[model samples]
Target chain A: MSTSLDDRLLALIDGGDDAEAIQQLQTDPAARQRYLDLVALQIMLHEKLEGDAAVVTPEQEAERLKFRALVWAGALAAMIALAVTAWFALTASDVNHKPVSVSHSIAMISDLSPDARFADATAMMNLGSELMAGPIHLTAGRAQVVFHSGTVVDLTGPCEFEMTGVNQASLKLGRLEAYVPPDAHGFTVQTPAGVKVVDLGTAYVLHVRQDDVSDVRVTEGRVLIQTDQEQRELAADEAARWRISPSGLASLEVTRTTARQVLIDFRGEASQGVNASERYNVFDPVGAWRFTSAFEGTRLFSNLHDVDGKPTGISLTSRMATTMAAGIAGELFVNPVDGFEYNATTDGVFIKGDPDQHHVIFHFDGLEPGGKYAFTFAVGLEANNQVAPKIALGASTQTLAPHDKTRVIAFDDIIADAQGRIDCTVTPASPGVCFITALRISYQALQPTQERMNP
Target chain B: MAGPREPEQFVQHLTAHQTRLRAFIHALMADWHRAEDVLQETNAVLWRKADQFEPGTNFHAWAFAIAHNQVRLARLRSARDRHHFDETLADQLASEAIEQFADLDHRRQALAICFDKLPKKQRELLARRYTANEPVTTIAKSLRRPAGSIRQTLYRIRTALADCIGRSMSREAGQ
Candidate 1:
């Protein structure tokens, strides 16, 4: 009675005095005025309380309700933030140049409709319809495929192969280099000779030619090669050829071989786990371009540099890159085919490539028309002081720098213009460590896209 | 009863109940977004647990129960840290008045539209005095204003909004 008319009515309803409710309803003028208006609410609340017996005082109910409201609000914001952070973290990991492992087999098919039954000995790649026994199989595409388990393969325009029987596989016509895992049960590439490759616990490449020549090269670890008639264990920086016609194995100097070099660097503190909280400033200090990662699952630092100690004119990508390299603990962060830029502290470099493919690209943009460039790549030597020389893929010889204690390699000078993309590859003489950090490249005139037609 | 009504029957029932339930939740939560979330969660729960409910037996009651629980849960989740709000009980009374009118879905919609059209200052006073459960003294203390001034302001706002609601209803009816 000391309350408002509304409160009193509510109190009556709460108390469950129905007989008194009707009498109280009849006497109060305000209650009579809103009699019909209160009917539905009365029925609903009455049923809600009496039917379920979940009756509660208003204070207690309000306290419980406010708690729920706050929790819902916080949870919603947290979920969105986590999603964004996860996306950027996945991308930053790729920029720092970490290796990726083959968590799933990427199967790609060359011809969606094919007549030939690719033989069991065909080297199946992550790029073709070889039907890999894993989560992701690249079904149809001519891709330089990299698996999460540090396996890189260049599946040509058409081929098929399967990963049958554990690590042992049968290749039809593809080329591949598998960073043999320590746990791998000696993967056998069954050619006509049934060569069993013992796990050297390192990275090696294998290629099958049209004339039945199986070219095997060891990049990092030692590889044991076997034929129906002969067996050989080749160390890193060595290669051997097995001819199907002669049915014999011949050891060859790896210097006579051809391959490409991929140079990448990181610019900031690498992501701790799967996400990054800080944004690193990574940019191609030389050109007008876009930034991209090499592949999915590969981790990279926030910085990358070309052989010419200059910004590659490419920033760290915002996508996960694939991991592919031999014995590399993590995944290699591959740059995208485009460009981007930002600012951050710089980290070291990561070198990764597909073993079978002979072409490594020195990806650069924003170059001058005629600029002098010089660079140095540090080389790590084995016990014998033998330098790991990479095969210069496109143009080989140039002026060498003063060799204080090592080889100062160089490249041919060329004019750069806007008419084409300035991309080249430098092959290493040996395989163990073919990378240089402190490099120099001079800048010259820039040919804009519009100037091409007018000039 | 037989397989708990086909998908088609369920869809039809949902279409019929969705608007009504939405309006009901909107009134209770006073937050459109929260209402929508509760509606979605309620609908999903209703679908999964539809088998437990007998067919043709007070569908609204069953649905309302689910919605009520969802609202309670949502409120608890949002206000876990703040056990009490400093709005007047009169504010709660005003919101309660609207809630009383909320059962009529059409009237509730019309009233909500009119409510939003009111000035922000007036709406705040109304919400504080009527919708929220704070006592007048508590509201005055929180606002750092005199209780008499707040009461006078509230009286003026109520009279104006009553007139606003009446005009808004007539306009909608004419339209």
Candidate 2:
């Protein structure tokens, strides 16, 4: 309950009738003291509106946030937190979205997670380690990069990221979850695709793929996403993907969910290589395909239906690869025209390169609607990986290493369509000697109709 | 030597207490311009009563007491004036303000911190209202909002500021 005089006081201050308020102040000592306190506060506010607010951080905790909020020339108040060293190389930029040539260090790696493993290039960045305005490639684990502008970025590897400015960074590849406080409203993350995401005091996660495609999801507050072509605002729980194709830069808003975290791990290099392949069946799949050059028997094993032609839980309805019939080990192997037919004991399957665009589209049906799936596969080739095939699931794509054959990549968050279908695609195929093998699809049902499955 | 330094010391004391003296007068008698007149009159009395002031005494308390007497005499002289207040109320206001003389600095500093916590728009509006001295009606018209809304926003801002300052003071005390 308010002291009824507060209304009278507010009304009195606004040129309303002050007789009641003045009478109350005259009689009640408490009212008089409160009136004086309010009046004093008013006088001070009038004096402080244009001045600086010196936030005095007590001497108790050195790790706690402590900074002086200084009003800059305009509405933008530039705040620098001393949590990191403020050694600004301080060269001015051209004021364009082009990458700033940073001469001095403006940020430091504040902390590393328990399992964080920095790449050999980033080996020197421990706690309180300063970062030059350049690429920080982490082969494994997570790190927290604290900028002098009070923007903190929690980065997970295998990622290539760079600190571009005191309040700015560029996510070239990998995942970064940024926390931009109000004092650091203009904290920016520039993707390799020339898309700049400027924070309006927000916490957001950005993932940059190998194909210059950046996906940004705002978890709190708002952000301004700008490219040379267009600009848009992304609010909380909203997500958009930016891609720089041959045409130009393009952005697409996607259906955002809690799957963003899983996608970050999917973007990481947490691979289950050949050594871990024996344990790959830890999560049972509706169907597992192992493609090989050798044909054990003329048995046609289809994913369409079982004995009674009922719809299977998961079925590869259609697939396409540019026609190729190779005589491997004295047996004729032809690419699938509409369906993949293989023997029960076949080692692997051949995914052909499309003649026109080299894009292999696989429309897998009978999935649980809105269900998240983990599609893990390995590339088995007698020759070196010249194809370097990429697997595309919705807004994310991962490319295989040319020298690595043991590494199995898992796309952990491919959401199925409402019609229980996944329109997955494989792209930019090179004609060499390779086939996708040990391809498995498994997921705990994301809907009520399904049961949770564990690996 | 003490007699020679008396006028200089008195002038320094009067000069330093000018703003606080005016505010103290304003606290007693609501009209700020009238408080100004009373503050000038109080300054003259302090100058005339300079020889009576003991050196190293609480200058604000001594000066504020003189200012309170001047406010009482001014109110007695201006019986027909609109803002003339009750004498008992005036005495209480003067005593309380003098007692809080030490805390005024801390409250003012705390206000700086509290002001920054206000939303940017509210802070700008408050700054414009006080520093630029813009009226609420004009602000409402310019902002394309109702005068009542503007008044309500201003009230809310003031309330937040007052509460924030109180919290800051309490936290400081605890620390």
Candidate 3:
């Protein structure tokens, strides 16, 4: 192995892939030893650095220093257990045998968005604070309520929510998203008019507006929504909507919509593909772009603007390595939305099929470092079952099929790369058929959602 | 089958090898936080299988076998985002890592002695990257340097640390 073994191993530890370095470690004896040495060094750094994160005050640091040798050898496990034994076994043998305070709190606050406001308190709830079953009203802000059973319910208020059980909750107003692990099976959510959404284990989103309407979209797994009129099972990517009119009657509608679209609709954003004749009515966009034919090889500005309607400095370059042989125009297509009749995308950048040609690549730059973002885009697939198209974002890849003729794909909580770069590639099943129709990106904070916090 | 061992003996063996078992998992999986969770799980299994451990046998080796199985099961259950080696590659690395991490404590001691000698700025950078689990690209952006340069700088510090550790270990062995 070479001297750059250090760099290679460093990169690998940092989540970079190098087949050659891995191969060397497998075949070379000296390299293997060096790699192991590096691993040991990493273990020490992790142990100490993480210990620093845990021991906060000077007293805690002093306590750690008293048994620093044990701490160095990953002794936290043995020491914490020993400490409990030392304190309880010797002093309180009576209760040590078996007696303790019972906790009535069934859930904990996992995350709260920056602007999250609870109706009980006009400020943020501390992350990991335990909650007892009662009403949870949020005047504004988004919060993730995590049940001890491993289910997480994300709520966006002005929402009137009541925690009825460890596995049950009522969404009387605003929006609720439930992410249930298989162990958290039978998790249920109730809406107004006594409609119950019993989840069989899925990641789903729901919206309840003030106008007596509640919409639920199942993004990954199946969702069971039981209404007064009917009980329906919504499969992946299917949506269920309940509307109650002032006549005090409830109505149900089953439709097809992505989680992204339902969220957009709930926010009262302009509907995408709602009117074929009316131009540019899109879902909520921090940035929106259309690959006009005139936008060939030239950089075009996005319709993204601030509250004052100034540009947000987000744009797209229409250079796809293989530019459509000069003077070729964008292609127009009809995008079928289950309930909307007049849904179509105007002219989009069309690519001529070349089997060996590289798929379309777009590098989104000039983003704030460490920001979490979600983006949704539309693709026009000409055939129902030609081949599955692949989309690669960073190192993660997903193969998806068109929903009818047009597919709107959205990915959430994608952490921007160190260079603040988001590279997207759309690979067509057939060479000449793939078309880029539209795309939008939104910024979101992930610390509230992604980071694991203990109270 | 589970066999018989003293509870104190089992706890002693398990805790002593916690750090090494962690290193073995890191060899197969790239995510450090996930590795810690696997280590905890492995410790639980080791406790349950305490009686299965034959007396006079090498405890680290036995513990490594159980830890390897836990890592295998975990990777199989992981969701998208967490990274791991394939089954075949992980198996190969597991054996090698189990063998290599036997003397891990000594290497770790040497690493500490050498790591403390690094400049304050370099140490802080390392803490930011590994402790805070920040990415090199973000660090690069903050430093106003190219991401490649930040990576190279890290590589140099790590290489120097490794060299110092190797020499320290050799000096102690000679004495």
Candidate 4:
């Protein structure tokens, strides 16, 4: 019977088919369709199953070895570059540029949060302060620098950059977004890998990995990137990557990708109603809870349930729930609401009072040992002038300040115990109202890297 | 740096379809590392032959053809490896899979729902078998179960998931 034939086909697909199953599939259209569907299912199943389980053949092993060698070589070159730079800084006198006074400032610190911290106190530049060519290290929060020529550079810490000149800067670590206007044409950003990115007239994001591999994403206009041996011009929505080999050899690779592609985050908008259609498209979460008034009557929400209408085994405990208008003073929001109606009332749950009085707790059981998980949530202060709340997930606790907008917090790389249970708690710092709109707990998967050049 | 109309259109099409193109190559190669290599090589070729690709045509099909050629070339290079499938069977499967590309998204959604419906034990087992790529024998040894029993359990779970997915998809169509 075809039932037996179907089973046979399934087994064959699992084992990489023999001549018989392939013959059967070639002749019968029904069987062929069944095979296709099952194979698709198999592929989907294979995707869900991750980790190093498959037996690595000799070829794969060789590829892995080659990759490791390249990475090591890149590291060696970065160390060499760092050493050379340090040596030049100590020995070279007025060869590059005239030594400026301590009070001389080539750029002004345009904007920064109150919480922004700098590694070097002397390196901190205020608005309209003349900035000398020196290292600027942002220890925490974000900082914006406006070059004398009008190039606005936003640096997110922990980041390190040096003002080489009024028209030039060098990113040593972390990420920076540079908006180069027409006046700032030829403004250059030198990466640690010795690649110089000269803006023709554009906005671009430059990220320097800890390994010194630099990634540049052009959001608008165009930019020319030059290494000692190679130079390439990248246009809008294009990305160029430069890396140095262990042998001090430099290479570059270019691809067409948006800046958004480099950062992994949830894509769909969160609202007040039940988002039954909002399924996670990229990575699956272990437990997810949407605090919107979508399910108003239900006092208990399960963590294993999908906000998009799928059921799971685990559950989350909510103390109080309510619906409110979008604009609540002191509320902090991470996403923009340009298209959303301001007057509309969205559903949300509140965690009020102090930690000892009332706290929202999420219990996750059966976590994989040695597995890392990310606890993400959308939260905002409901009342004006309320103190920041304390968020506890696993063993770590974070104190968050009160703000008018909603902020999404993602605590990643939290390891689970052998028992697989992780207790997540969110406690308000004061006797004020705080709202949680969305929550998700998912396994942490490493971001995939692009292919690199051998040189 | 904007190029002629053909190159601009090619870049646009390629960028839009990059994810799907990688997925197709992944389906063909099974190994992500290998699929990445093939996709990169295919991208270079696609860019070089951008003039040959029509502006208004199906870029997905054009890209898939190039990826398919690359997959065949890779297979030939690694013919001595014992882990890969027979060329004839793999080709047949690849063709069928490509033909069903239009239905991929719908089937994927159904599969996601069906996956959530599985019992915790079954989910764990499936994860071990699929995610960890642990062989059935190795899993059985770890769990102190017979290899045959473990295999049978996997088969039953797969059958149940397939039936569940079919029902959900049909229900959606009816709605």
DockQ of each: 0.02, 0.07, 0.16, 0.09
Which runs of model 3 end up more than 4 angstroms from their true locations? A53-455, B1-4, B78-84
Candidate 3 chain A, run of 10 with poorest lDDT: A262-271
lDDT of 2 by residue, B1-175 (tens): 0111244555556655654665577667766456556655565445434544678887787777667655654553343456534656666777888875545667777877777777899978886676556688999999999988998888877877777887888899999
Name the regions of candidate 1 deviating beyond 4 angstroms.
Answer: A1-157, A192-194, A246-262, A266-455, B1-175
Alpha-carbon runs more than 4 Å astray in model 2: A1-4, A13-16, A46-455, B1-19
Docking class of 1: incorrect
Among all candidates shown, the one with the greatest DockQ: 3
Task: Rank the candidate models, highest DockQ first.
Answer: 3, 4, 2, 1
Fraction of native A-B contacts kept, per candidate: 0.00, 0.17, 0.34, 0.21
lDDT of 2 by residue, A4-27 (tens): 566567565444557778788877
lDDT of 4 by residue, A1-455 (tens): 25567677677665554567657766776776676666667766764454234665565456445534533433443444344345435533332243434455566665665456889786545533446678889887677776666688988778899888867889889888889878668889887656888899998888888885778988779888877776778777577877777765376778762111111112212222322223321212111123223233332434354433344344443333222211111112222221121111122344445456656555566555666777766554322224444678867777655552325566877887887667766666665555554455655544333544333
DockQ-wise, the better of 1 and 2 is 2
Docking quality category of candidate 2 according to DockQ thresholds: incorrect
Backbone clash pairs for candidate 3 read A116-A141, A353-A431, A353-A432, B3-B51, B3-B52, B4-B51
10 residues in a row with least lDDT, candidate 2 chain B: B1-10
Model 3 clash count equals: 6
By TM-score, the best candidate is 3
lDDT of 1 at B97: 40
Over the stretch A1-455, how does candidate 3's per-residue lDDT look in tens digits? 35677788877876678888888766777776777778777777767675767435564355335334433323433443454335334433222123222446666676665566877773336665667677789886667787666677877768888877767788888888788888777788888787888887798888889988778878668788776655778766567777887664467767652112211110111112323222233333222222223334544334334222334454444456553321111212322321222233322333443444645566666565776777665554432223333567766776555343225666787777787767776565544345544554656541211222121
Span of ten consecutive residues with least summed lDDT in model 1 chain A: A336-345
Candidate 4: CAPRI quality band: incorrect
